[model samples]
Target: MNVVITPHTLQGTVEAPSSKSIGHRDLICAALADGESVVDNISPSQDIEATCQILQAFGADIQEIPSSHPGRAAYCVRGGLKRQDQPLSVNANESGSTLRFLIPVGILSGNTVTFHGQGRLAKRPLAPYYTIFDEKHIAYTTTDGALPLTVHGTLRPGRYALAGDVSSQFFTGLLMTLPLLSGDSHLQSTTPLESASYVNMTIDCLTQHGIQIDKDWNGSYHIPGNQQYRNGEYVVEGDYSQAAFWLSAGTLGKAICCTGLRPHSSQGDEVIVSIIRQMGGQIEGKTELTACPSLLEGRVIDVEDCPDLVPVLTVLATCSKGITRIINAGRVRLKECDRLHAIATELNKLGADVEEEPEGLIIHGVSGLTGGRVSGWNDHRIAMALAVASQRCSGTLVIEGAECVRKSYPEFWQDFASLGGIYRQED
Candidate 1:
């Protein structure tokens, strides 16, 4: 789908979408637990939906409960894996996080699992996982270190050390799988873990489900094997990552109010609020959830661990008064799209001085953007980021391939329209 976003000042309030980062962990935890578990406030996005489907394929009983009232739904998930009637062929689609988190968990069930993904995911690297599997004595095969991987193993619990720089999904995979293993497990990191906030989210979900993973002084994860997860209720929090788009839109328009996010969230994207505030955006309301426009001073930010924010932050950079530098984001190039290049290329098309560096980007802010057609690279973040950037543009910004936002935020366009932003569907 292509989206035509005209220049408009946004107003009103909209709750942020549920965090897939937390929701994915909650679902995995529920699937690992015994008995029935209720997960509330979860989203129906494609990424989380893929995870739910995969867990069901491995024998988890999931029921979608409808509410008598409007806008209410919950999932009842019965945990523990049972062998499928046929060989399991898992289609991960385009969600990298789903593929990485589920693959190792699937390995623990001793099922002959065949994994597949589309587009860039097919070419994305899984070399680190292959090496980890080899070291752990897990049986696995990959086609030239890419997806279409096959793994068959019970994932025996043991001591393992993994690098923390490349991606947190690797560690999240192992951390989630260890409890189901045969023996106690220990994981030590070689470097100061990047994206440590995400690891905290994983640990938080595991703890809520009655699973214990002790963190040592050195930040090693100590998991006692054979500990089953306790089934209960989980309410997913709002996604600060998705909020970045609306927050950006608001900053460029009339003061907008955002709800559904906690101020003290473990999410790294929460830092975006402070970053925006420093850039001269004023936030009002002394409540857990509220955001308003503030001054935007273009400045440099290091997003080494929170690479997902690069797109929206880059959009905010376009509206700043001076040059804004985004550094420590080399890993973003390996995501759904080459985000660094995508940000630079799209921003440049809108008449912004954006320089794509080897590690980050340099954006020289201007009075206003001169809008033109831009590609979304079939990346959800890029799609939403461009839409937000269009708010202060001189003309309509046509975002080709904007439908990619459905992977995480299905209601992005509708929500934007509700907030007084104009979104017309253009073929």
Candidate 2:
């Protein structure tokens, strides 16, 4: 789908969607629990659905219940890691979290489990798991380092060493599976851990499900054997990653009020609030965030911990004064899209001065943007970033593949329209 956005000021309120990161972790724990678990405040999206469907295929009974709140659904998951007798082939469908989180669970089955994925997901790194699998002499095969991999071996619980700089999803994968092992396991990080907030988020989910993990002062994790996941109710908090888009619009437009965000979330992307303020965007309210246009100034930001914020942050940088340097964002190139390149290229096409670097972006802020045609790069964040950029455009901004926002924020276009953003769909 394509969309044409006319330059207009945006204002009004929109509730943020549930955090996809938290939703994935909660659903995985709920599926592994001893009894039924209720997960509330979930908004259905492609990534969340991928996790739920994969859990179902792993023999967890899941039922979705309608909630009184619009765009929210409750899930009752009868938890277990029961493996079916039939040949097990799981399709991750471009969800990196689903594929990474479930690989260790598949190893626990002691059966040959085949995993497949689409899009750039197949190209994402999985070396962290392979290193351990090799050290433990577990049998596995892959299409090089990508997906369409198969693993057949009993995971022996012991010391599993992983690189800290790699994707934290690997650490999370092991953390989720180690508790299920018959013997205790120690996860040692070979280096300083980046994206540690995600690990904390996983730990938070595990603790909620009655699983306890000890963290060493040196940053290693100690998992006890024979742990059980207890069934309970979990409410997913609003996503700061998705909210970054609307809040970014506030920096460039009139005002944007976003509700449903937790003031103290472990999500790394919550730094968007602070970063916006650092760039001179006015933010007010507590639970309900209100961002208004201010005398925007450029500042340097390290994205090693919050790679997901790069796209929207780049958009904010474009409308600011002086130079905004986004560093430590090399990992963003491996996301659903090459976010650094995509953001630099797409926004530059709209007459913004953005320079792409090997690991980050150097953006020189301009007074305004001259809009033109751009591609969404088949990425949800990129699509939304372009939509928000349109608020400051001097001409109509046409974005191809705008429907890609369904991956994490299906109602993004609707929310954009609700904020008085003027746009029309183009076939």
Candidate 3:
């Protein structure tokens, strides 16, 4: 779908959607629980559903029920993945998280799993897990880094070395399967870890499931064997990454208050709040984060921990008063689309001064953007970030593939309308 937006002032409240990061972890843990578990306050975005559906295919019974909060749903999950003699087919639907997180689960389930993906996901690198597979002597076949990658053989827990700077999702995949092995396991990072917070969240999720993992002072993870996932109720907090777009819109337009975020969340993307604040935007609150209109001053933004924030933060930087340099985010290239390149290319199309760097972006702040049509890059973040940038546009902004928002925030367009954004859709 294509959406054309008429630049208008945005105000009012839009409840932030449930955290996809926490939602994936919670649902996976719930499905793996020894007994029935309730994952409350959840929304079924495409990626979350991809993970959910795959787990169900593996024999977890998942039923949707009323959510504790309105505009959301709950999952009653029981049983766990089972080994079948035949192969299991799992579709990732362009979600890198589901693809990476479930690879080890398939190996541990003792099933020959053929993992597939859509769009640019097929091109996304799975090299990290490939390393472990080779070391563990797990047979796997892929089509030149493309999807329908099939894995065969059982996963034995032992000392594993993974590159820290690559993708943290690989570590998360192994972290999950390591505890279920018959023997204890040790995962050591070969280099200094970037996006360490995501791994921390994975550990936190494991702990919530009643599994314990110890971390060494040197940042290595130690896991014990024969651990079981305990069933319980878990509430997913509001997404900090999705909230970023609304917060960016607030900075450019009117006042916007977002509810449902966890205060001091372990989510690395929560740094969006501080990033906006550093740009001189009037944003505050804990349980509820509010962003008000303010003239922002450009500052040095780091993408080491929060690469997801770069696209929208680039929008924020474009409207800020001076030069805003976003550095340390080469991994953004490996996402659904090359985010650094996409954001720079699309925003530049809208007459904003954005330069793509090998590792990051350098955006020169202008008084306003002269908007035009741009592609959504088939990336949810790129699409939503463009929507936020529309508010500051001096002309109509038409976004192609705007429907891509369903991947993470299914109700983003509705919420966009709730915030007084004027837009129309096309086939």
Candidate 4:
């Protein structure tokens, strides 16, 4: 789908989308719970759907209760993951979180499980889990580090060691499964942890499910075994990653107020708020994240922990005064797309000067973008970031493959329209 967005000021307030990261974690725990779990504040998205479908296959009876919010719904999750007689075949779509978060659980019963993924998910590395499989004597086969991998082995209680820089999703999967074993387990990170906050989020979710995991300051996690998952009610928080686009829109145009966000969120993307403020974005209100039009000045941004913010923050950097340097973003190359390259390439098409680096970007801010045409790179964040970049453009911004927003924010276009965003369909 092509969207032609007129360079117009966006106004009015819009509710933030629910955090897909939190939604994935909470729902997984809910499915593992002993009883019915109510996880509210869910918004429809492809990635979330993948997780839901996989859980359903595990015997979780999930019912979606419709809500007045355009993209929001509540999921009542009952039943729990049960060992099936037949082999489990999981199609994870293009969601990396789903494929990684459920791998350990899928192999717990020694049932042969085949995981199929599409698009870039095939390219995403599952090496960490493969290492674990080798150590645990779990048999597995892969298509040369690609998808359609099969694993048939039992995961037992033991101390596991893996690199933390690859992705935190691996650690989350192990943390969720270790407690179900008959003996206690410990996890040690071989390298310095990146995206550590996400692991913290997993710990918190497990705690709510009546599971306990102890962590030392050195980043070692000690998970107790033989634990039960007890679930009650969990309210999903608003997403800062999605909110960053709208907040960046505010800095370039009219004041935009974003509601439904949690103050002091553990999600590392909350750093977006501080990134904007440091760049001279006019921001106020904690409960309601508000950003007003201001003269933005370029600053240094380190994305070592919050890689998801790179695309949107890159948009914000385009309109800043001085040079904006984004570093420690190498992991972003392994996301939905190479964000470092995609953002730099797409924005440069709109007349922004962005220099792509090996692991980062050096953006030379311009007065404004002389927009023409740009591609979404078939990546959701890339699509949304371009949409946010449109507000600073002088001409009509044409974005091809704009529908990619459905991956994490299905209501993104709706919320964009609600905020008086000027856009119309194009061929």
The per-model lDDT (C-alpha) reads: 0.84, 0.89, 0.90, 0.89
Better of 1 and 2 by lDDT: 2
TM-score preference between candidates 1 and 4, better one: 4
lDDT of 3 by residue, 1-427 (tens): 9999999988999888999998998988887777899999987799999998899877799999898799898999995888876788889989989999988888877789899999988888888788888988999999886788999888887899988898899999888888988889999999989999999999988998898999988889889989998898999988899999998899899999999988888899999988888888889788888899999999999889999998999999999999999999899998988999999999998888998889988899988788798999989999999999988899999999999999999899999999999999964
Report the lDDT tens digits of candidate 1 across residue range 1-427. 8888888878889888888899899888898888888888876788888888889888898888863323535788989988766779998888888898998888877688999998898988777688778887778888788879989876777788878877888888888888877689898887778888888878877888888899998899899988888888888888889887877777877777788887788788888788778888876652234456656888879897578999989888878888999998988999998999998898888888889999899988887889799999999999988888877788988999988988999888888899988878895
List the lowest-lDDT window of 10 residues for candidate 2. 105-114
Clashing pairs in 2: none
Across 325-389, the per-residue lDDT of candidate 4 in tens digits comes to: 99999999998888899999999988899999898999999988987989888899999989888
Q: Which 10 consecutive positions of candidate 3 have the poorest summed lDDT?
A: 79-88
Q: How close is every model to the real structure, measured as TM-score?
A: 0.96, 0.98, 0.98, 0.98
- Going through the candidates in order, what is the number of backbone clashes in each? 9, 0, 0, 0
In angstroms, the error of model 3 at 219 is 0.6
- Give stretches of model 1 more than 4 Å off: 67-72, 286-288
